[model samples]
Target: MKKVHLGLDVGGTASRWVACDPDGQVVARGSVDGATAHVFNPAERQRLGTALAQMAAALVAEDLVAVGMVGGLTGFGSAAAAEIAALAKEALGLAPAQLLLTDDIVLAFAAQFQPGEGHLISAGTGSIGVHVAADGKMTRVGGRGILIDDAGSGSWIALRALDAIYRVLDRTGSLAEVQRLAGALFALVGGSEWHHVRQYVYGGDRGRIGALAVGVAQAAEAGDATALQILAEAGAELARLAQALQTRAGDRPIALIGGVLNLHGSIGTEIQNRLPGTPISQPNSDTALAAARLQASGEEHAWRAILASMLTPPVPSLGSSVSAAAP
Candidate 1:
């Protein structure tokens, strides 16, 4: 019988999995509602665990054991890796020795970079920049969360847009621009008044507020100066993040990941212009494959060996959009 391998990538917006048999062919693939370990509410945390359990049960069939498994999840750290492993062991029927858990950034980085020096800036509901050194050292910047950091992320952009809407209302007092631009944005959110936007924002969770960035992006594309400026500033902030990582880790190619950056968007152009001589490449595989390629030994070649067996290229990320996946 062929051994089964499993890879899971969980983010704030969605979770995805890919399973491969010993023959190196994909046997099972699926997605589910987002589950991250960053929640503070007890009920929300329980929901996350339940979501993980459901995903695991759906992927692995009866009378079959998962020989090995790896998971790259949001808010995962040394402190939480063990807990995640325990969860997986119970939920997936895997032994402790057969599982590995790590931060989603690791999977995102590995998806685009190889066993060398490279930098990655990922923006989504949250943002983080990572630098993997030639000596196998890892350095990270940002990704602290919405309240304190994540400068270039969707939440950050949404907050900025909200601030702009307030500023325009306070400064302009029904100017034509406000009625034409900011008012239109408000309407898109189903709010006839600013207080309605406030109610909608406060009524939902962080992901709901973060989803407002989509309206901002749409406004920018429609030639809203304020929206355009907001996106430009976002690009500038992300470039600064890239520059910070490159300065410490030495100049290297940068990979951009996440949903906020459209292929034809100004953010990519801004990053390229700011970081001269540094190449920016897209990930060849999705985060699930990257996590699945992780080896028990945690060596560079071990990962490379797994990657070399891939029969197909990576699919796009599950949470790579402005709106969070509906639960």
Candidate 2:
């Protein structure tokens, strides 16, 4: 039987997995619905298990036999670690020794820098900055999830835009006078009515709300001042995360990861402008692949080197204006 190792990167917005052979070659890769690591929540626990089962089914379809697995789960907490592990073992058919689980952000940090090497700023559905020290201790800033902070995160940006839109509506009594951002939000929410917006914001999860950032980015690209300002503020918020980590991270370079950073050029530009002279790099390596390698080798440098080898050349930076129609 051909042996394979599996790696999973589970987040609020999506879950990605990769299967790798002993030689570190990717054999199969796929994505399933997003799931949180909050196993204490019955709903979240079910979602995590379902996503794992779906991944298992995909592996079975490809005739892959997983020898071991590593997973980085969002919202992972020590209190729920055992429960999360149990769910993974039951869904993936793995033994206790065959599994390793960690926070998704930790895996992201490892993918880019070795412990004590750099700080990582991750802005996806939520945002956080983290640094792993030489002694394996971790220091974090601003990863409190959408309910609290997550300042520069996708959800934060979406909320800011929504707040602005509603404020305008309250004053004008009509969205007709509102510009590109209002239209973009209206189209995304499926209508301009208060009920439509409320339903979309309240009825859905954080991922759904965070997705509104896409429309916000589109509006900003169309020169909507509100959208532009929100994105700039987002960048500044992310910079603050990095700055906060500096007390412990100590002059380390910053690695920017996550979908929010990719939403618009303005976000990155603002980060750079706010934190002048700080070395900031955006590494595009696949975290799932890195996780797979870690499962296979059990050594940090081994997986890091393998992932580095697979890095694609960087694409040119996006211009100030992203191409998309408002709404």
- Please name the candidate that would achieve the greatest lDDT relative to the true structure: 2
Which pairs clash in the backbone of model 2? Answer: none
Output the number of the TM-score-best candidate.
Answer: 2
lDDT tens string, model 1, 174-247?
54564445655576678767678878777776777778788788777778888788788888889988998878
**Alpha-carbon RMSD, each predicted model:** 8.3, 9.6
Q: Among all windows of ten consecutive residues in candidate 1, which has the lowest summed lDDT?
A: 304-313
Give TM per candidate: 0.84, 0.89
Model 1 scores a C-alpha lDDT of 0.70
Model 1 segments more than 4 A misplaced: 38-41, 60-64, 295-327
lDDT of each: 0.70, 0.83
Candidate 1, 261: how far from true, in Å? 0.8
What does candidate 2's lDDT look like per residue over 1-327, in tens digits?
A: 467999899976679999999878999999998898888789989999999999989998998989898788887655566798788788877886677677788888878888789999989888888887766656778877687789999999999999998898899976554479999988888998889999999999888999999999999989998999999999999999899888755889999998999999999999999888989999896999999988877774443343232222234476752211100
